[model samples]
Target: GQQVMQIPQYQHVQEGEDFTTYCNSSTTLSNIQWYKQRPGGHPVFLIQLVKSGEVKKQKRLTFQFGEAKKNSSLHITATQTTDVGTYFCAGEVTGGGNKLTFGTGTQLKVEL
Candidate 1:
């Protein structure tokens, strides 16, 4: 079975600080999709990167596609209470019925 995991499941940061989280998998994937969930809300689509060596950013957030497509990362330049949420990366398995498998996911909290 393919496995995906993310480091620093929870992060607490002061306002205006920086934060980062990493996602990894035991097997490669065709593509990966990232989502963000508010403290008490459902996940909302963020972005998707499919090509190796690809990178995309929205405001202070950055997303990277691994060279092998087996790993990915998310970084935030400056933290704000508004950034508080859980980040997830979902990938597809080689031969699984489901097209998407999720990472452990990183939860971010920004302090005042």
Candidate 2:
């Protein structure tokens, strides 16, 4: 079984500051998916990274996949109250098919 873990289990950032969460996998991953879950809400898919060393950006958010394919990171620029949520990284190991191992998650708090 593969394990996925995220660092900085909790993060607090002032509005206009930046935030980041790092995800690491026990085994090489074929692909990784990022999700955001607001308080009392189910996880919602945000983006996916497949290629090694891939980098993607959506608005003020940035995502990067390590060249080793075993780690990934999500960064938010200029944090806002709307950015408050738990971020999760789900990894699908090589040959694991559609099964995904989800990380413990990183809870983010933003305040003015």
Candidate 3:
């Protein structure tokens, strides 16, 4: 079975600082998705990547998928109090059912 792993399980950033998180998969992934979970809130889909070596940006945030499609990363240009939340990366394993395996997740805390 394929598994997804995330690094820097937790982060503490001062407001206006930058933050980043990395994710890797044990096997090639068909596609990968990113989600954000605010404190005391449910997970919310942020973006999805299907092509190798793909990169996408939303405002001050950037997402990247590795050329091997086995790794990914997310970077935030600047940290804000509102950015305090957990970021998760999920992917579908090769030949796997329509189910997704989620990484451990990176928890972000921003302070003023």
* Best candidate, lDDT: 2
Per the 3 Å backbone cut-off, how many clashing residue pairs does candidate 1 have?
0
lDDT agreement with native, every candidate: 0.89, 0.96, 0.94
Q: Provide the lDDT at 53 for model 1.
A: 73
Per residue, candidate 3 scores C-alpha lDDT tens digits across 1-112 of 6789999999999999999999999999999999999999999999999999999999989999999999999999888898899999999876777789999999999999
- Clashing residue pairs, candidate 1? none
Question: lDDT value for candidate 3?
Answer: 0.94
Poorly placed runs, candidate 2 (over 4 Å): none
Candidate 1 local Cα displacement, residue 9, angstroms: 1.0
**Model 3 Cα displacement at 4 (Å)?**
0.8
lDDT of 2 at 27: 94
Angstrom error at residue 54, model 3: 0.2
- Candidates in order, TM-scores: namely 0.93, 0.98, 0.96
lDDT of 2 at 69: 98
Quote model 3's TM-score.
0.96
Q: In candidate 1, residue 83 scores what lDDT?
A: 92
Kindly report the root-mean-square deviation of model 3 from the true structure over all alpha carbons: 0.8
Q: Tens digit of lDDT per residue, candidate 1, span 27-103?
A: 98878888899988999989988898789999999999899999999899988898999999888765666578889
